[model samples]
Target: MTDGQITLTGIRAHANHGVLASERELGQTFSVDVSLDVDMDTVCDDLTHAVNYALVAQRVLDVLMGEPVNLIETLAGRIADAVLAISPRISSVQVTVHKPHAPVGVALDDVAVTCRKDAE
Candidate 1:
């Protein structure tokens, strides 16, 4: 596989994912960034030869909008796994999950976790 990369950033979804009960009751927005290491040889004029990014985004959104996890780290890993499962052409994936309104009770721009997964 050639060292080709594709990225989808700023994928936003609203969900109940946090350590607080209030968070689960009142969901917040989460932003995901995904980076994929793929086989450049598969890149061709035909859409079938390449990974469809729209589907990837939907998959990420599904994960983000599906379950409630306490940590952003878990959310990141789940997103990575989901993205990698999209196609064998994707060798590895990096996922970053951002939680803007964390319950840390402090002023912060954002809180996030990043995780990477490689094909087995």
Candidate 2:
């Protein structure tokens, strides 16, 4: 099998997830980025030999819009897990969850957590 990487960036969703009650009650926007390492054998010619990224993105969105979690770190981990579960060809995945309006009491552009998972 040959190794290759696929990346998806700037995925955005709205959810209520945080330590503070207000964060959960009011909800906010979240951004996600995903990168996957895969093994393929198509010489870059066949969709049948490659991962279907549209499906992958939908899975990530499902996680984003599904359950509520307390931390972006956990969200990142879940996304990594979800992507890795999609196909055996996916050898590893990295997910980044971004919180643009984190309730830190300080001004910031964004707060994010990144997680990675590998097949065992």
Candidate 3:
């Protein structure tokens, strides 16, 4: 970030996704939030240079809907890999996977998993 620019946040996705016998059999949605740190100067100049939230969301949805995974952790990893593949300009990425209906035998709002990847 430079001048008056701060970290740009893309679109946040909320879906009930999970990995459990009951949850998967019944089907669930997973909510995902991605925070990316980018250079505003290049982004502000050209829209193409900026991170496209729609594309990012769609990429994540593709992974979630593509195959049936047994773990949200795996899903998070896949999301991170795909996002990095799509946009190389990204300096760092933070992905959070939220499972609202977990089978904990107790009332819980959601369980989340987060992963971060920085440029190498």
lDDT of 3 by residue, 1-120 (tens): 442222323334343345556665677666777776655554456768666767877887787676777777888888878887766566777888777766778998888888987756
Question: What's the alpha carbon RMSD for model 3?
Answer: 3.5
Q: What TM-score does prediction 3 earn?
A: 0.78
Checking candidate 2 for backbone clashes, the offending pairs are none
TM-score of each model, in listed order: 0.94, 0.94, 0.78
TM-score of 1: 0.94
Tens-digit lDDT track for model 2 on 57-98?
999999998888998888888888889999999999999899
User: What value does the lDDT take at residue 92 in candidate 3?
Assistant: 70
Q: What are the lDDT scores of the predictions, listed in order?
A: 0.89, 0.90, 0.68
Can you tell me which runs of candidate 2 are displaced by over 4 Å?
Answer: none
What residue pairs are clashing in model 3? 15-29, 15-30, 15-31, 16-28, 16-29, 16-30, 17-29, 17-30
Clashes of 2: 0
Model 1, residue 48: distance off in Å is 0.7
> Lowest summed-lDDT stretch of 10 residues in model 2?
40-49
